[model samples]
Every structure is written in structure tokens, then in C-alpha cells.
Target chain A: MGAIKKFMYINRTAPYGSIYSLEGLEVALIGAAFDQDVSMAFVDDGVFQLKKGQDTSKSGMKNFSLAYSALGDYDITKLYVEKESLQARGLTVEDLMPLTYEDQDDDYQEKPSIRVVDSEQLADIIAEQDVLLNY
Target chain B: MLHTVNKSPFQKNSFDTSLRLSRKGSDILLIEDAVYAALKDSAIAKTVKQAVTTHSIYVLEPDLMARGLQPARLIKGIQIVGYEGFVELAVKNDKVQSWL
Candidate 1:
């Protein structure tokens, strides 16, 4: 395998109203298959993509929110959620669906994949990324 | 006339521009990401509060709830409206302008 580069997918748009969030998720999953170090940062309205109990039945739109749960299976486990964005939208971490991954080295112990970070921490994460894909 | 804004005040000038160009007594509805401008204690809260006196400001209830924003957290003068209310505003106004 070649040297694994860090790939960060930055999501800033809301779901349902636009196609950005869903497309970003799909691209992230496809990118994960390449075996690179993939992570996702949810900022601004992008945080809504991870909201729980999303009922699209009335809207007649596909409920793609559930697909976020499968990110762990693709080994794209690092999901960074910005605290400031959540606070601005009056959302807390509890409002989001719980996503977890299993640690292979630790007897497959389950661990949370979503990391709630402040803007400062998120800025550092963005600065460290080798490639940034914005949605 | 009814002016609708669906972009964030922090990210775009949609809210400010709509507020500026909209005539007094016009209905201003905030939906989608634009609901952020209705938040209390935000950077744009003061401006929204000021605009409330000259315009009838409304925020989409479903959009607010979808964003996990409580109605109480919104600025004092802004009214919360449902989809039906949105339709009523559209019917009441002579024209509808979306500030993209």
C-alpha cells in the first residue's frame, strides 16, 4: 500500500433542502475504500445531517440520515462535530445520533466516533489535513 | 410584500441585504439556515431586534425545531410560524421575494 494521506471532508450545508450533505457522505464512503485516513468535520448547518429521528415520510424525501451510522463499517470513524455550530443552532451532542466504531486492537471494544470540538480545535484539525473536501 | 431569507447571517449577507432593501411593514420570514439570524444573543441579534420594529419578522417553526432551536431562544419580537402560516403570509402579501 502507498503512504496513506489524511483526507478531511468538510460539510457546512443542511440536508434535505440541498444535495450537498448526501453527496458529501457518498463521496466520503467511496473515498474510504481507497484505505486513506479519512475524517469528516460537520460545521454550520452540516450538523443537521447527523440529527436523530429524522422523519422524511411527510416530505417524501429519502431519509439518508441513517447512512451516517454505517461510516464506522467503512473505517471512516473520525467524525468531528463543531461545538460553536451546534450552539448557534441550539443543538447539543445529545441531539445527534450516536455513532461508534470497534477497536480491532482492543478486543473489538466499541468506541464513539463523533468528537465534539470547539472552533479552535476544529481549526487545528483543518490545518493538519493533507486534503480537504468541502461540501 | 414578503421577503424570505434562507441563508445564515454569519455566512452570507442575505439577511442584512433583505432587511436593508425590504420596505417597512413588510413581512420577513426566516427559514432554513436563515433561522440562525433569529437566535438571541447572536452577533446579528441586535440588528434583528432593530429590524423587528420596522418589519414583521417571522421564523419557520419546523425549521427552528429541525435545527433543535427552542422558540424561547429566539429574539423577543420575532414570531414563530408553521407551514400554514407561511402559506398565509404568501397569500396575504402582494409579492414574495426570496433572498438567496
Candidate 2:
């Protein structure tokens, strides 16, 4: 009904420490219904949300990290992760879950959606957004 | 762009990460608990002092006062602004990024 607006959800909190990380993901999933241009940026401790093998069994909390792999179905494929954030936390791209989306424009070929960017590059990406939602 | 950090730098990496990622000449506004980073003698003062060269740094006046901090105690090059200034910063910038 309206022009597609760029919506970027910046996640800066760690998972399980508080509810921000999960809430951010939930809102992003819900926002997908509107079909606007959506992207998520994981910065600071937010990178923890994508870490592989998250076990919450002892904490009794649900392991929602798996839900990220489903984002491709929602058509929310862009997930920019800050490289410095990962290094500061002693993590690498390999430590994250392999999230991919089938590129409809490219004959439905599966393609990686996570882009690990340096701070300078991430700043440029952030400046181009029409709306920024922080969590 | 304008970047706002609301968490304390001493307690969180929000301030450092924001400072590192914000583009050159971008406006960085310290508000809420983040105003503490503007103090001249704080552990982060050196970093704030260095950031001023590349970015315009501002602290919420009310938040600073509420924390018992005086303007004279703030690091040089750091300006103090009120709520109106906060709104103005948001309006002036093409976008606002909050480091929570």
C-alpha cells in the first residue's frame, strides 16, 4: 500500500542475559509480514544470538537460536554481523549457524545471507537505512 | 547520522562499540547513564577526548546534573545539551542509531 521502507534492527545485547535479543528477533519476524525491506545487524554482544550449539537446557530457557535459520523463509535474508564484535568476543564466522536463503532471482540457488563486516563498512550500511530499530 | 548511547561505558561495551563504528564527523550523543563517560577524569575520558577530534560529542545536561556531575568536570570538547538538543540532533541527522 505504501513505498517499501528500509528497516534495520540493530541488536546489541547478548542472548539470555536479558530479553532484548529474543524480543528483537521476534519483532523482526513479525515485521516480515509487512514485506518492507528488512535487515538485521548484530553488534556488540548481539552477535551471541547466532552462536552455534546454544544449550539452554540447564537454564530452562528455550533455545531460540535455531529460529534464525528460518528467517530465509520469511524473506529476511540480510543479517549483518560486526566483525569487531565477534573478535572482541573471541568468536568467528564459523562459530555461527550456517544461515542461507534461496535466491529467487538466481534460479533459487542457496546463498549465504550473513555478511561479516568491519566497523567502517557497517557504519556505511547503517547510514543508508531509512529506519533503525535498536535492541 | 546521529548515534546515541544510553548505557554506561564502565558497565557495558555499547559506548566503545558505537564510537568505533560511527562514521567520521557523525554526532554522538551521550544520554542516560552514558553521560558518565563525558567526565574529564573518568577512565574513558581519554577515549572520549580522542573521539572529539573525529566526531561532535554531546552529553545530556539533565542526565549529567542528575548524576551530580558538573559541566566544568566534563572533558574538554564535550558539549552539554538539554532534551531539546536531543530532539534537534535526531531531527538534523538523516538517521539515528542507538547503542543500547
Candidate 3:
């Protein structure tokens, strides 16, 4: 295994506006294959990447929001969503997709990995990462 | 701080804004099209040279090559790094701010 470093992926762009959100998800998935400790922080318009029931058929672009729900299967369970970002967009956790993972340990109980944090707490999380990749 | 800029200076003002806002002695890594700013004799190169007086600048080698820019074409005082060096910079810096 490679050196296990703390990696925090910062998502600050909105979904479908630019390619940042999808590209960020691609990198996070790639990082998971490396066996590093990976976490994601949703700030600014990045919180929109997690909104549920996104219909992109009209735009002819593939809707990739469902990929966020599958992240836990890769053992990437740390997803920090900034509270202020969501509130500024007039969204709540209820507007996000229901994401839960079946933990292999502890009898495979399902648990939610999405964490709602304030800006201050998110700052702390950013400070704690060994590597921060912005997308 | 290690600042990574991936946008072109001509298309976006992020490279200029990053130079304006970064603290003195901060390192800026020009990746993707931002490497164009480091090209010798370019208009933005002069401003980038001025930035080198206070900030240590680096460019992603692969990106430069991908864009068909030769290392010799880059202005003095700017270094080139590969992917491993990119990770090293992230580790060496206290914080990283991306110019998006």
C-alpha cells in the first residue's frame, strides 16, 4: 500500500455549470483506489452536487449526482457539507439525496456518511488535511 | 500557502487575482493553461516575473509539454515539476488555495 495520507477534496463549484463538480467526483473516485484517507468538503455552490432528483435529460448531460451516494461503497465515508453553503442556496439536508452505507464491520449496519457542518467547523476540517485538492 | 492556478490568464483573471492576493513568499504552481503566463516574452510573463520577486513560482511540466511549450521557452526563476513534485508541494506548504 502507498503511504496513507489525509486527503480532503474541496468542491466549490456548482453541478452542471462547469465541469468542476464531475471532475472533482472523478478525482475522488480515483483517490479511493489508492487506499488513501479521503474526505470531501462541499462549500460554496458545491453543495448543489448532492441535491436529490436531479433531471439533466433536458440538458443532454449525464446526471452524475448518484455517484455521491455510491462513494461510501468505496469506503469513502467522510462527506462534510457546509451548513452555510446550503442555507445560502435555500436548501436543507432534506433536499439532498438519502445516502447510507452498509458498514462491513459491526454486523453490516447501514449508516449515513454525509455530515452537516458549519463554516467554522469546515475550516477546521480543511486545516486538518494533509493534502487538499480543490475542484 | 501553495496556490495552484489552472486557468489561462487571458481567458480568466484568476492568475492575476492570485498574484494580487497571495502573501509574499507564497508559492504559486501554474498548471494547465496557466503555464502560459510563464512563457518568456509574453505580456503576462513580465507581470509573472515581477511576481517572482516575492513569490516562488513553479509550473507543471506535463501541462507545459501537453501544451507544446518547451522548458527553454519559460522565463527565468520559474521551476518545473511533475506529479510527484505537485504532491511534495502540497505536503510542504501549510495551506493550499486553488485559483479557480
Candidate 4:
């Protein structure tokens, strides 16, 4: 009956190395289902999450990168990355997506896209959120 | 005048959230595992340093020693608060948020 609420999901872990990344994604997906406007901020090693070509298959893992694309369909469009993190890792928005594992075989597939910003914006974005869940 | 908890945010979301939104003068102490910010001299330390100058920020001395971190490595304005000093910090801050 009130207005739709805004939710912020702060992810601070990398995938594979720990269970935090996958679990955080599950939480974000659940939040999206409720139609609560959702956004995600990837910090520290968490930036590894949106990498362009993830090969979890060889590591005996399901390719979670596919799940990222599904976020757009759920209206969870605001995926933020720290510019400092990006530079620290020698990464750029262009490096994040534009290729996929399928492309390794010369197939056509669109990978996930990462929007980059600096720490200043990261703090501001956190402050702007009505409900912030950090995991 | 300030308090700080160096624990990872997600590991202690409730405590970290409280620290972030606490009164302007309140401080959130950082040290040990929380000292990950100081490792690479990253934004976390930068933000904490700025906050400490205007507010209060404390670091756990024991934890830093365990990790082989020296006081000289710590950013300016940040103080090394011992265990007893830590308890005193909790008593001083209006509310205490433990991120562990």
C-alpha cells in the first residue's frame, strides 16, 4: 500500500574462493522477486564476480555468470563496481564483459556488464539506499 | 568521542550498519582481521582516517601485533587502543556495535 522500497545489496567477496558470493546473489535474487527495487555494489575482491569470462566449469562448478544476465530481466539493473577496485585489479568496464566462455569456442554470447565508479560514489550510493543489506 | 569495529562488514552486517549510522561523534574501531583495509593502504583506511580526524577511530593493538602491523603503518589520526582501552571505548560510545 505504501511506495515501492529501494534495497541495496553490498557484496564484499569473490566467487569460488568462498560461498559468500553465490549466497549473496541468492539473497539479491530473492529480493528482486519481491519487486523491491534492487541494486548491488561490488567491492574489494567482490569485483571478480562480474568478470567477462568466468570458467567455473573446469573447476567443477556451475557457471554462475549466466545468472548475472538474469538479473537484468528481474529489473535489478544497478550493478555498481568500485573504480579503485577496477584499477587495482587492472580492470575496466570494457574488460568486465564483451566475451564469454562460449566465445572461447568462437560462439556468440553476450556477457554481463559492470558499471564502474570510485569509492566516493560507492559511499554515496550506500547512503542513498533505503534498505542496505551487506553480505 | 568515537568507536570503531574492524571486522569485515558482511561478517557482521548488523554491527557494521549500526556503526555507519551512529551519531557523528561515534567511532568505529578497526584492527586485526579488520585491518585488511590497512594492508594495501586502501580506501577503507582513507575513509576511516577522515572520520577519525572529525570523529573518533580506534584500532586494536594486539590484533595489529599478531598480524605484524606496526603503529607507523597506521594512518595519521588513528590511535592504537588496547583491549582495556577498547572496553573503555564501548563504555564511552552511546551504543556499541560488535561486528564479530
Best by lDDT: 1
- Model 3 has fnat of 0.00
Error of 4 at A111 (Å): 13
Off by over 4 Å in 3: B1-100
Tens-digit lDDT string for candidate 2 (A40-127)? 9999767767877665543356778889999999999999999987765446788788999999999999999899999999999999
Error of 4 at A135 (Å): 2.0
The digit string of per-residue lDDT tens for model 1 on A1-135 reads 889999999999887667888899999999998999999999987887887766654335677888989999999889999999888765789978899999777898999999999999999999999999999
Residue B64 lDDT, candidate 2, scale 0-100: 60
lDDT scores for all predictions?
A: 0.87, 0.83, 0.80, 0.64
Clashing pairs in model 1, backbone N/Cα/C closer than 3 A? none
Which model is ahead, 2 or 3, in terms of TM-score?
2
Off by over 4 Å in 4: A98-113, B1-100
In terms of docking quality, how is candidate 4 classified?
incorrect
Provide the lowest-lDDT 10-residue window in model 1 chain B. B64-73
TM-score winner, 3 or 4: 3
> True interface contacts reproduced by each model, as a fraction?
0.07, 0.00, 0.00, 0.00
Clashes of 3: 0
Tens-place lDDT digits, model 1, residues B11-73: 789999998998999999998778878878665677888999999999987777665567767
Candidate 3's error at B59, in angstroms?
41
Per-prediction CA RMSD (Å): 2.8, 14.9, 16.0, 11.8
**Residue B76 local lDDT, model 1:** 91
Clashing pairs in 3: none
Full-model lDDT, candidate 2: 0.83
